[model samples]
Target: MSDQAQSTTMTPPAPSDFDGRRAFGRAARIRTPRTSHAVWSPPADRADPVSLLEEQATSRVPDLVPVRHGRMMVSPFTFYRGAALLMAADLATTPNSGLTVQLCGDAHLSNFGLFGSAERHLVFDINDFDETHPGPFEWDVKRLVASFEIAGRHRGFDDKDRRAIILAAGRAYRERMLAAAESTVLDAWYDHLDVDTMQAWLHDERQAERAAKRQVKTFDAVVAKALTKDSMQAFAKLVTTDGGQMRIIGDPPLIVPVEDLLDDTDIDDPEKAAREILASYRNTLFASARHPLSEYTYVHMARKVVGVGSVGTRAWIVLMRGRDELDPLFLQAKEAQASVLERFLEPCEYDNQGERVVRGQRLMQASSDIFLGWQRVRGEGRIERDFYVRQLHDWKGSLDAEKAVPRGTLLYAWICGETLARAHGRSGDRVEIAAYLGKSDAFEESIAAFAEAYADQNEADYQAFTAAVADGRLRAVHGL
Candidate 1:
């Protein structure tokens, strides 16, 4: 298909009012142990991807006080990427079982990773939940499948191979969900994948693909790099002298120093104000039953530019010193707002969105960061937004997407499915979703088609964004 013709055909469904229940029926049949769960319908107009993204971004504006103006003018693709929550909203309003647990709305391959669990084990699971909300489990599965298809295309995989990968992922999800449904709640909750367990799992499979083994080795190396004190020092290299005072690089929204962003505030003393904020954040940590910062004392705070999608958003890296200079803890306080799922979901009663994310993360992951917690801050006027805090690099690591092979992708998909099943097992024990999905390859085929369509849409959006950047519609600094 011609690129322009494809663009015209790829225009996603316009935002419209939708009946969530009807959409669910169209998407899949919901089967429960008893009667099927009642599904809430969202308006059809709200399902439009463009509208949903705009709404999600609008809601976050009030809370994103650090860098104003130019931050919002990014290219269309950049904006779309940042607005994943909107994609969640669109997906949630689609047909789904009302059996909802906390969901990692953005359950793409890149979102899964290794992090320090409370047990001190490096567990792998969903690492991002910026759009987490109570919704149908199928939404996450579909999104993940679609992401796989899109990523596969990006890697130049042929259609047949891409379909195989999607099917493998879906089958893995269905089979694992069935197993989890049969397990005790505690057993399912405790089930997690650590490095050793993952290695063993691969070893037993006896797959002789050198490329796959190399990917595993790379993951181990990356984890090793992040775990050492030397790596932390490397991060400190960003810190430089500014007028005789130590400051990290500040480039507007991406990397604004805390002092510059909070300038003209009534707090008189920037350091003191930062300390008070840290105290409030610490209170949140204490409430979570996991204290990663208990041994450390707050020493400094700096604005940090992070993630491809979250680059322009307000994020901070706080430095804490314990025992001495050699002992340090780095905490990330990331700004949070209502997830893209919010508009489509029933209004949440919780006042803090960050807490909502943290709680959802705890529910979805077999293990989570010890310091995960939420804090509410009044930015300007009465505007309020939630912020979740976590240890910056507590043995946390991820695979480099560019280097991942097809089999590596397959293994990653399997792990993702297993993890999703565990998360779904928590809220509803309906073995029917698993049964309906069945051992057959039909569901996977359906998802493969869906992924191809969605990926085409993503490419179109990416192009639109790049065009916007070229036209000077948005200010963007890449490769930071």
Candidate 2:
């Protein structure tokens, strides 16, 4: 149909009493559980996973690509985290329910964690949004559940234990989605797993009063640590006063100052570039959030590479000092690219990839960073990139794998599942999702099976990745 004909159809919207419940019933007629997620098998024509990594590397910093490879080479868990593009490609062929939401394109065990909410409370949510976009919600859940299956291998877990964790994560998602569906819109909006609330929830299971008090205190300290870790933390970690003026201490290929990166290019005027780019970022924020930035002045910035998948991305950390020497804030500006899902799904609503991250984050998270914003970089001669900026760390800490006991892993799975459900509920039709999930556990069980099958595929991919590195096709620098 032509555009004018399609417009005419919308002008006379009297399609026999349409409503949300009826719209949801209509979605149920699409994908079925057995065909949707149960059957999982790799195609004969599956693209080489390493080639996908190579394709992604073309857009990243050339030198840092080796670091990304090295990180993925560490273990299957790390490999899964770094191979989001590979998985995205695979998921494109999988059966989707034809429902879309703001997806965390790289959802995995390591990607969900603790961050300070705008109210200064410790909240658990998806902490990364580099590839956030509107796509099938199951893509996020499948990646999340599969992460547990892959990580379990690193911990020397048996198939039964791995299956149990996968089921636990999937069940949590199903149950939470049902709860959100039954809740009032306001309740769903307010739902979040904050530190204090979590502590209270755990209280009933505690034995001794004194021991429980100590545990709560320990949790409090962990949350408080994020507040203390600010610009001074970045200052001490990334720079030092040497030979007259302070400078970002070079940490080889990982932490290269942008000045070293550009030489005597337009970046030679570092302060001027910082001022102009920062103004662009400030304009992206809400008026209230933008005003507070005026209290601080830019001190220094360095290209600080971070995360297994994110190692090669153009990420810069900036330090801004406030009224006094003690008052400092650290902000991160990371490069944004079109989401991996864009190839299979509709194009993103926003033109700027950075805005896609920021807006999608606000829609999914219970609360967002007050300083969250975006900027477009315009250098000489077609040098342009989009970046999203936020505080480097605001009492932010992630659960360590060292502490992943069977009991703790179960709890972590629930936390991740519940948080992910909340994120989807905020942007998706929870009622429809809950209905599709139904009274049975078939959908959850199918995902767990898919997780196991995908875990096997991940191991195979890991082997290929290592072989390429061994043959010198890929360069990997082991250890930091």
User: Poorest 10 consecutive residues of model 2 by lDDT?
Assistant: 1-10
Off by over 4 Å in 2: 1-19, 22-30, 206-227, 242-246, 264-268, 288-290
Expressed as tens digits, the lDDT of each residue in 349-384 for candidate 2 is 898999999998999999999899998887666577
Worst 10 residues of 1 by lDDT: 1-10
Model 1 residue runs over 4 Å out of place are: 1-83, 209-213, 229-253, 264-270, 286-294, 430-432, 470-475
lDDT of 1 at 313: 53
Using TM-score, give the best candidate's number.
2
Instruction: List model 1 lDDT by residue over 162-248, tens digit each.
Output: 777887787788788767645665676676678778766666556556336666676668668545533256347545556764446
In candidate 1 the C-alpha lDDT for residue 79 amounts to 38
What value of lDDT does candidate 2 attain over all alpha carbons? 0.79
TM-score of each: 0.79, 0.90
